[model samples]
Target: MSLFEELLKWDKDQCRVVGKKFELGSWNKLSEKDRLGMIGELIDLLCQRLKIKDKPKVILTTLDNAFGAFSPSENTIYIDRKTLSKGGILTACYCST
Candidate 1:
């Protein structure tokens, strides 16, 4: 099965194996630089399950929530989606290695 399928299945059956909501909060509370770095690391872990690229298919609730993705290939950062005006929660789907 694909990594995405496996990860989704695990989340459905076991719920939390590697990273969960509570654990994510601790990780998210880090500094802006740290958060971005951690997110990058998390993306690596997630890649084991999916082929993640620099451009991600972002799914956002509002255009105000902060969002960014590191483009390793181009060696640059890109904003897949932005929530510049509205206010709401942001849910980013990340691939884990």
Candidate 2:
């Protein structure tokens, strides 16, 4: 079976995390523009938490077979315009972590 299938079959509760989990209300109902705004907010929060000096610039682009990439030199994040972020805490930032 594929990895996707295995993930689907696994019980989500099997994994436990200590920190508080953030829950977004009406996630599916949010517009693309709203979602992008949320992503920006998440990034800002993360930067603050990590003590990052300059907030990384987020640029949406047309990518092939990939969701996003981070450039250290440029200090920027590039997300695939075609695939916007999903809900559930840092799912938008970390992608199912």
TM-score of each candidate structure, all chains considered together: 0.39, 0.61
- For model 1, the superposed segments whose C-alpha errors exceed 4 Å read 1-4, 11-18, 21-28, 51-66, 69-90, 93-97
Q: By lDDT, who's the top model here?
A: 2
> Please, what are the lDDT tens digits per residue for candidate 1 over residues 14-93?
22433442254554455544445544555565554455554333222332334544455555555422321121112444
lDDT at residue 95 of model 1 (Cα atoms) = 26
TM-score of structure candidate 2? 0.61
> Number of the top candidate by TM-score?
2
What are the root-mean-square deviations of the candidates from the true structure over C-alphas? 7.5, 9.4
Off by over 4 Å in 2: 1-25, 85-90, 93-97
- TM-score between model 1 and native: 0.39
Worst 10 residues of 1 by lDDT: 81-90
Given candidate 2, what's the lDDT at residue 69? 86
lDDT of 2 at 40: 77
